[model samples]
Target: MKNDRRPAGHVVAIASGGLDSTTLAYWLKADGAAQLTLLGVDYGQRHSVELSYLEATAKTLDATYIRLDLSGAAALLAGSALTDARVPVPPGHYTDVSMRATVVANRNPLLLDLAVAHAVSTGADAVAFGAHAGDHTIYPDCRPVFVEAYRRMITVANEGFIAAGFQVLAPFIAMTKAEIVRLGTLLDVPFANTWSCYQGGRRHCGRCGTCTERKEAFALAKVFDPTGYETDGG
Candidate 1:
């Protein structure tokens, strides 16, 4: 009898070089259970710093890093801060509806489609993302409901050709950014290697929505945050 249940397949991880995604990559590595392929999508966001950061992270983790260019999609969706040259990336919490300017239309869905394609082509059994609770508040696609729905979509979307099947694993969906930071620290994730500033500046703006939340997470976690921020208190 062939051992079909072996855990020896590639696992594609959607890495954006942010706190959550980077932490997810490290968590998978800590488990030491399967091959990992890191996917970093370039959707023409002002911040390319995170892409470079992910390359460094992949090097450190010794995982294969794939940079997929979806800048065309960003060009098409120009109203959001992430793609538009006019709107500024709102400097507030993820819950602030105004901050929705950063969300590209169906952005997560697009990236997940590419990731799922790669998984099917490579015979991987799973695809992972870093959609934590904070994102669920703002991004419609990052919520648990979307994740589950997408899981079923992909499964049916990639039927018998991919005999093994796939699952959308979100290990941090229920946790706040603070709790994620705390847990990631415990996993020895190199937070310093990650970048969260959406301003595309030389250093973290420290005032943007992502920066504020990142600061708040570390503050709440009581961990020494290595992010380059000018402010001292949240």
Candidate 2:
């Protein structure tokens, strides 16, 4: 069923070139979004290869691609394994204790703010991102409460503007990653082009929390994953 809450107009998607975000982009396109803009943030994370995927995805979807430089801010937000080389990217399932090392502070909030601002500037009616139920346990920003609060804040902040009725859309907020995979598969998303490894090697390490989760989601969804992994072992 199509979400009636989603306004019918230009929409900006926070694309990270990961499974979730890429899937979201494809979903938007499938839903006949008139004007779609993909916003990618370059935050100097270890998995910079995803930026390449971001570009490719934009081309595939025929959407305008905009890259924002947040590398300077990443320096101050160091200490997380993703942005700091000194810290090791943890290997295990997402629920493991060690996976907390990968959290970047206020990542979702910062990215959403940028996406929302871009939408406002472009006269877009909505801004979307892929935040699923699985992330709620590890990322507070991905939780429903945070998203609802952010939506309210954006509504209040844009008051009186010509295109003031902006929406923060998280279509998969209550769905599991496996469910997202199934939806993406149905939408024929190019999964092979998406990147999820924190190591940022030539191929996915297949050991990091993200890689593990990606593999698990595919398995749970019964979808054939086309991602190239460095190792056969999960």
Flag regions of model 2 displaced more than 4 Å.
1-4, 162-164
- Estimate, for each residue in 1-234, the C-alpha lDDT of model 1 and write its tens digit: 021122446778888998899998888787663788999988888897789999988998889999988777667888988778899888766666776777778878888888889988888877888888878766899888898788789878788856464567777888888998988988999998899988887778898888988989999999998987755453
- List clash counts for every candidate, in order: 1, 0
In candidate 2, position 93 carries an lDDT of 83
lDDT of 1: 0.82
* TM-scores for every predicted model: 0.92, 0.95
lDDT of each: 0.82, 0.87
How far out, in Å, is residue 106 in model 1? Answer: 0.6
Can you list the residue pairs that collide in candidate 2? Answer: none
Q: Which candidate gets the maximum TM-score versus the true structure?
A: 2
- Kindly report which residue stretches of model 1 are placed more than 4 angstroms away from their true locations once superposed: 1-8, 230-234
